[model samples]
Target chain A: MSIGSTIICLLGALFMTSSAFGQAMDAPTDLAGTGYFRDQDTLPGSFRFYQQLPGGESGFWGMGPSRPNLRRSSFKIDAHDDVVYYSPEVRCQKCHEPQTKDLHYLRMGITCVQCHRGQPVAGVYQYYSPLNPIRRHAYVCAKCHEGATPSFASYMVHEPNPIASEAQGRFPLLYYAVWFMLILAGGVFVIFLPYTVFWWIRDLVAKLTRRPSHGS
Target chain B: MAVDRTRLKRFPPVQRLWHLGLLVVFMILSVTGIAWMYFETPWGRGLAEQFGGFTGTLEIHRIAGLVMLAGFVLHLLYMLFKIDWKRFSQSLMGPDSLVFQWIDIKGFFAHLGWVFGLRKYPHFDRWSWWEKFDYWAVWWGLIIVGVTGLMLYNPVLTSDFMPGWLLNVALWVHRIEAVLAMGHIFTIHFTVEHWRPSAFPYNASMFDGSVDLEEARHEHPAWVERLEREGRLEGTLVPPPPVPLRILYFVFGYAIILLGLFLLVFAIANAALLTLF
Candidate 1:
């Protein structure tokens, strides 16, 4: 992309997408790098990003129902009972229904030409390998889900503090302090717990069983 | 009904006020801190929504944490100035002082023996070994939480002096210490401090700043005996609190304890459900 195009993209993103924490979202102008996205699987066990955008109905016996529409555009699973996950089906024109047909990156459906640019293809259908395999898929999906052509949500909104999820190599002070705290708490709980529980029960039993002999 | 209607001082106004402050701040910190730490959970998400959102909850946690640390500093200052320099040495090693003595070590075993019915009710002074332990636990907890909290609060500044990884260390330490505090305070403190039958329902002494004379004698026979020997028992006595003041103490104590118990139970149940399923 040219410098002029980059500037145009950034400027366009500023107006198009804003975050809850107030920052201009980066428009994902380069779609191929985002990652491979297959909209729907053909069969039951064949699912990746989503299982299948099941037909609009109450669904089969044990499976969850498909969504009525994408107006809400939410992503969730029943967690406890859902047998299979599904997504709303996406036909080309269902997404590309805008008047400005050329650059409807915000509300448009994806096509082969969008990311493949000039790459050769042998068949009508072939799974494209993710250009940036290292990036999290959640982030790649967030480009469209959270933003129009861009994703403006701060990293804080997207993920936890980077240092927190991964281990910080070796810190003795941390281990020592954690151990000290654990030992202190553990010692109190382990050593005195029997006596503590015993006394509590004793007090409770004494209260329940014994009558107050003194006059009121 | 004829009530003895005699009272003795247990905590002063400053200490009582500090206790109230700690209660409020600790409650806020625990709720806000856990919401973020356990954000992935349903309860965590539910609480985060109550405080507006995750960021809002985080801000509240930070502010309340700073307030707690400030209260801690003020308390230390109060302790220093509250004491008389003329008797500084005595205060350090004094029987009345919160400082641990050889007797506390012995008292620990004696308490165990008494609990098991192997010994007579162990002798106790103004502060029992467990009481001192409770007091000092909070003291050390603040230091750990405060230091690590500050480091996490400003990772950039902390990372300048120390490695970046210390923040992770700080995170776990802060979390473990805090959870332990919640567990200890909710279970053990509630059990021993106010739930004891003699002090059952609610201990008005903490709020009204005086234990009934019977209370003092029951829990602190050695202290009461010392007062009697020094001819100070009569001077230390006061009339019972008014019925309305007693009612207020009951309300206040129950509110805090009930909230604490609810939180403890909720956390345990939530963890159990998450783990089992």
Candidate 2:
């Protein structure tokens, strides 16, 4: 072959090799077919830069790279435990349709992420569970109900279901009782605190002057 | 040394100590309890922080409540054992007792008349009608507040016997009773016993357990006359309180009174602001 033709052929072969490698990198993984699972990768942009890692597992394959199967490796089940794991693909309405009838937020079409902290997108959701030791329900409730008064917060959160129902049914009773006591106490204070202070000052002045004090 | 015939015994040493202890404990309970109730308010928040935060405030409140309960129980036991039961019972039913009697109704009207200038100061015995009211009201308050306080202090244990709603009820009752007791003590009781023109600044009889004989005669002539008839006037005479004791009384008495007055104003102002806004 002529040297110029040989150089052109070599350049073409190099281009083909590089292009083939690029195609391999760009191709999507057949994650389910490979018996591997991406724990929380269902949400778009949720695992953005780390999508290739797939559930944070590490391995190399000739075709491309093997993604992780979190279910098989990282996930463990104990017979003694009672934890239930709901799939991200399952909508809350699917199971909670009965309970959501009276829930205020659910009726308003506000999803779990509104009050809960975490990512929820592209048919997937991830949040701190109540079972988690670090995150408590009160902290989550406070995220949205920060402006609520202490009494209201206690009534809503701490009171048992029956007590809360009764309290709601007789809301006016609690309201009036609190106000009545406050007003009664305030009235007594207003009537007597200033009256006593005034008399005390007057008596002090009378003693200093050695004068006969009124009502003495 | 000649006995200071001008002074007469009022409260004895033990009674004086009990009163002083009660005053201190009651003040502590009020401060800690109010701070807990209004924990979100600026003053309340500041107080909680000063005491090492919300849990610390709660612990202090519970401890103060327990102390108050102990004091009350001890006082009751002391009265039961130390007092002559027959005399005490007779006194409770008699004209000299601090219990509410038919005469108190007459005395209350008489006092109202005196206030309106329709009569002179009605003759008062050892215990006036208002004084009787104060004593009985305290007893009633102790029972209600004490029981509710115990229930609240042990909600988990109490929940087994009582419905959960009862805890809520107990909370309201405890808070309301506290307010009532505080209001009565800081206002009517303080005014009648310490802030009155005759006892202005304070009634040091609670500290030194003695009163000026002339003032005692003026305030409780019926008791003085009875004592004189029984020839016990001389027996009740005591030396005038020494200067140092008087100074100490003035300092502690005024401090407590002034602190109570400040709290009263703060509470009322906070309540008004809360109600209006």
Candidate 3:
């Protein structure tokens, strides 16, 4: 590429990376939706407004406070005494359903832990989030936290390697590496080798037929 | 006074043989090595498969790696013992020379300017910065590629001590380095040696063991001047010594051509198969 193109691409890349960081930080930390949070009394599906459900509960569709503040409700339910995990083994996939209904759901840029909080599978507090929310126990959290030696970020923070899926044979790196290299080598050689061979033959014919030009 | 042919200051017989040997070995190794790396390409994977499997590429790659290592050692010995060490050092690594100096950055730009008629031709001496860069790049590449290549081939040995993630990093570095080396060879090296206007056909100094006096003066003026100063000047327009290299050239050339053809056929077949996928 020309110097101008290189500089333009570099500046563009820098701008994109900076804007990505900006968008990440701009994400709302509070679970409450914007307009609905204007008044606490009119919190979606609260007791004061609609208390005529099958179970005499105010929430619609029996979805316990399907409002975004369910996360806040969970926090309020257990204030002083924090919920914990106490499982022999703990893994992120246990709660996160390794495959979502939509392929793009995971690819939608939503952080998994943002909604599925606590010790992944074996950790449920009050407010009853999922139908079968696993209760929090100390042992489950200890798998990744509270170690003498600091564990990896995957353990402590749950940051996954971006290329993890590709590395795990989901995408065939070896297949590409082997085939691409061979094909490229062959294709390129095929393109040029004929000229080289012809040149060599031409040189040979010149040598046999006449006094050589002795071109170096 | 006319000089006897035997007393002429040509490269030593062993040096010439060593150069030729390395040239052949390195060429094969480079070809096979590169072929393996591009295994996803039509030729690369097919060649690897023909060798038996993925392990075949590794085995051949290791063989080439050994040959290259031997070449490197022999080169060092030739540098230290066979050649005039002072001349070699001055030519190959001397810092005070413009060829090895930072101003070669200017030479590069100046050459580009000459390409567009903004400046005169770059009057380089002994070695251009590009040549020096090529030399240094080879050494750097050998170390980086050689070490990583060994580690990758023998995972059992590596896994004994090193972390798993380190292997990943090494693979990344080795692959990228190969790409860089290939690019430099095909483009910069090709242009410098053969694609230049004067040297359009080819430069046979490496094969013929003597450069044309005019070429010596033009391309490497310092060496020519040094020879004159030392009263070691050969004839300005003497024809090259009869090398009898055509037979050798035909043999090596045809071998490469045949191998290249085989690779081409294999690659085409591989592409057809991949299309079915």
Candidate 4:
């Protein structure tokens, strides 16, 4: 209500907007499937790699395996489970062109289920390959949960080193930004509204009554 | 000093509605808000469980917070339109009210002495330093609480820039701040308005939008003096009948404090019983 209060409110609003924008622009690098090793020197040794070919699943490739780009080896799937054997082999071509595929997965890394058809189910191991112990194993918790097909945590080349294929979930910041703006705006109003209303009525009455004022 | 009855205008309908709405919602919100922060604490857990658990309490807290936030925005816009910049600056940017001044600082110490009759009672104005402190503290608290609250609202979005630890820190700060704020509001703010000897009952100016002349002079002499100087101090008008509205305020305020305390006690008792059983 008061000019000072209004200005403060505006400033708060601006701060919130800027904070939100800053957070949105600065995205976190997802680190799923990169084989997070405790030691930086052991990063290469910690990772195993694989890619599905036309007919069968590939063996676990070492850290510097032929396909250095494919960071994850989802080969642990047991042959007995029909769901595990029947998963589709997704390639870059399905979501984006070949050109963007490298950029999307490698340059701008993404999470496991981003391209995968099924939601990840917890506590069910479908694929296992000892060639690259960590990367070759696949667990689909969704197999037991609702609406789950065979699922695997995919690996991205550009993902941060030493990643947990399982620990992929992240907290959301933009939602906070939006909410922060609204709350800040609200706070500003709460701070000023009372005095403004009281003053307005008081001033209006003073003028209407032709009250002689103390010149001070 | 006397209340310039002629000068005191009736609060607008919108203002009244806003105050009433915020009062009701804030009270509910505060309860649920505290319950949220303490959901893990023994008392908080009990409150949450009584209300049907954390999920249910969280839902109500969010809904109430949103409503309060809406009220907050409307009040801001109203003030933006209501007050002139130059005049408003007197209250906002001018020197701190007397209660915040060096003299009042001295008064605080002296009043402590005066409690033993060594000095006179401190002369106060429309607002005291403690009141001002509370006002500003509430705003700051709201900002911290609101921001942290949002950050925690959606972990997926917040984890973009802020680390899990930082969110954890925010959570810690928000929770601690809520408890501290609850204590301060309950004891300090409530006591100032309702626990003093002369004004022991309460002050209902926040609700009815008016304070009687005697109260005006005793509580806000400077304002009374200003109205007198301006010749708008109701020099010729007969004063209105005394309304013991402060009594209502005292009853309501005391009731809330008692209820909150009782809730706290009951929670502790239940927790003890469960532990024993």
Candidate 5:
């Protein structure tokens, strides 16, 4: 894409990632979504509300890649403890299904609609908000706390060696080995690839001018 | 110049057939493998659709992997049994083998010197160091990828004996190796074999099973000299490949090379855009 399109897309992405402040759901008719916290009676905001679910009742402080704190980056199938893992082993929390879905029961301190809105596309922000809540987890809160699909933020962290799923706390050796391979591959490519490409260009120029090429 | 004389049969008929089979199978594997890796992306998903779908593409990749393994095994057996046990040892050190030699080590540095204009071109042999390196790289990729793919194929079977964490390692190795292979083959391998001025557009030797006498004299001078001294040079010369086969080679070679170029450009463009958008 042109520089203008890239800049426009970047600005649009930045705008879309803007977090919607957690709103209260006092009405009985309102929905208590996945991002909804069962009011710890701490400060009334979303972070205050969501913190209760992990450090409070579920007792699992970091049940995320799904709902880990902003610092939460990666996880694996065999991970556990403070790290994330399978639903039954570590976190069996209601990822999408709320604890109590009583239409009459209203336990929404931070409604998902507040922050998880707008489904933009191709540099168009608010392209599908409300009617089709962009529901993007780019802001650490997709519509339903999606754990299956990783976001661009996750990929940015997995850079240089970009594996589909990384082995972190589960296999500490492999985790570090992955980093080692990344640096090694980077170093090898950086040194060898450009040098050869330079040779190719030089040889091509010589051939065009009817000169004998080097290394023929 | 020996261009006026007959061409040298660099590759035998069977070897040429083997190479053609590998080219087709490898091209398929590379495409299907890329689709599997990037299935999350729209372009990847779209590519997968060409093969059927995600599952279909992966199935093709698996089948191609098995084919590659079979070819590798067949080639190894041929290498081991093609000659008597006594000659096998000698052949390992001989030009007949693809084994790396001390000369290759010197050839590499000498070639680099010529590239920098510090020396004349290095002596060309039956196989260049880079050619041997490329051959071995494929073997390395196959071993790692094939083993890991099998382990992951039946995770339950694997996890029963192997630790689940080992499977994680297998997955990591399988993926990293695939990416490394694709990146290297599409760029460096292509550049060396087909993008050089001497071989610009394409090289027909792999396709037609022989090199022109003049070309062989220039590229594999040491081997040609050895043949001439041993009085085996005339025996190695043969008429050019049949026209139909040459035509097929041109069509097939250009198509694959063009596809490789397109894929390389496509990947770079998307990767950059993905980081931004």
Candidate 6:
């Protein structure tokens, strides 16, 4: 064979070997593929972050009558007790309507899954779960809100007003004033403490030696 | 035979009792209050557990606060009974009173000068400027902490008349004032009273209600001179603290001083860590 044909054959072998290795490793076709759920033997949709059975009225058996309107698009559970259908994608608005309705950041068009993407339990998204296990909402807030001026980040988003115009709010001025006083008092005490210790030591030594100290 | 040296009556017996009561109550309040404020700390958590958890700690703190308030009220009543109407009115007016005087400003500056080796020690009367400051700080702390504490103790009720934020303000004030009061009493007041070279070891005058004649002459020469002029110098003489009581003072006083020092270190460390992290 000619040198050019030999080179082409070698390139073909290399490409085939790489493709085989990739398939063996179960590498995703696209970098952003959602990946498959092994237990259910189905591909998880882009929106479905959790792996558990869908929860809510239609998700749980005997909880309520199965609503055909809320059936899943991709998968269905066919058990002896009941057959249920679930959507390919699990959206947070399906369960948490009240909390997510008038959220300040949601008004900015930020999706819930953007901040809360993980599946805490098998069918429960992190934000939808009652127990917020990884409580780092402050750090999350700081990521975007804390820009040039970090002090602005101290403003509590939940309760923005310092004076309680309603049933509940913190007095920021009072909080800061108290902190200032505490820091000032602590600073003064620290500065004076060494002098006191010195005096005490001097007095002790004078008493032991039975000699008259200058101040005494 | 050596002539028995005369001592001067400084704090009266009633005054001494009040001081002791206030000291003990203040210490208890400080411990419980600080523990509750910093409940996340190991020492605070241990104290809470020792006192039977958070609720128990708060109960003890409230009780101690109330006791301190009562003692303060009794002190006010005692002063009312002791002082004549004329003296009371005079105290309301400036000089020779515990109220800050122009002389105190001068004396404070003079003392600063003396401290810097610019002059001799300023001649102090019955109460030095710092002593008067210490006295009034207690009154200030009591009013602020007491009123705020009352508001916080019944926040639900208080919120009916006032806004809920006011209760928040009260809580902030109460905690800060408590810290300030504890810090002042444990460090500055302790230093002035017990750790001063002149007051070396401890000042027994508050405990025993008597001062050594020489100490009286040295520390409060103006007052001693005034007593002599009034022919009350001899009347002021009293026996020193009894041996057993002195021994008790020696032990308890040192222990208290050491405890205060330890607390001072802990407070500083806690503050530094909190600020840094």
Better of 2 and 6 by TM-score: 2
Distance from true location, Cα of B17 in model 5, Å: 2.5
Off by over 4 Å in 1: A1-177, A205-216, B1-5, B272-277
Number of backbone clashes in candidate 3: 34
Candidate 6 has a TM-score of: 0.61
Error of 4 at A82 (Å): 37
User: What order do you get sorting by lDDT, best first?
Assistant: 1, 2, 5, 6, 3, 4
Summarize candidate 2's per-residue lDDT along A1-216 as a digit string, tens digits.
999999999999999999888873333354211211243323223332232332112211211112222122111122112326655566666755543432234223456545433432211122223211112224443455443221222222222222233433333334444555567667766865665565455546655766432233
Candidate 6 local distance difference test against the native: 0.59
- Candidate 6's displacement at residue B104, Å, is 1.3
DockQ of each: 0.10, 0.05, 0.02, 0.03, 0.10, 0.08
Residue A34's C-alpha lDDT in candidate 3? 25
Model 4 misplacement above 4 A: A1-216, B1-19, B34-46, B86-118, B235-254, B264-277
lDDT of 1 by residue, A1-216 (tens): 999999999987876665434764454453223332433221122222122222112123212222223221112122112323322243334533431222123213355334322233111112332211213223343444432121111111111122231211122343455567778778877866666678787667546755321111
Model 5: per-residue Cα lDDT over B136-248, one tens digit each: 87787778778888876655455445433354456667776776777787788888888798787778887777888877777778888889999999898888767797888
C-alpha displacement of B138 in model 5, angstroms?
A: 1.0
For candidate 1, list the clashing residue pairs, or say none.
A25-A152, A27-A150, A53-A87
Question: Model-by-model lDDT, in order?
Answer: 0.61, 0.61, 0.48, 0.47, 0.60, 0.59
- Global CA lDDT computed for model 1: 0.61
Candidate closer to the true structure by DockQ (higher is better), 5 or 6: 5
lDDT of 6 by residue, B136-223 (tens): 8789889989998887675445544544435444665777788788777776787778767667668877888888988777667777
- Pairwise DockQ winner, candidates 2 and 3: 2
Model 5 local distance difference test score: 0.60
Position A60, candidate 3: lDDT? 22
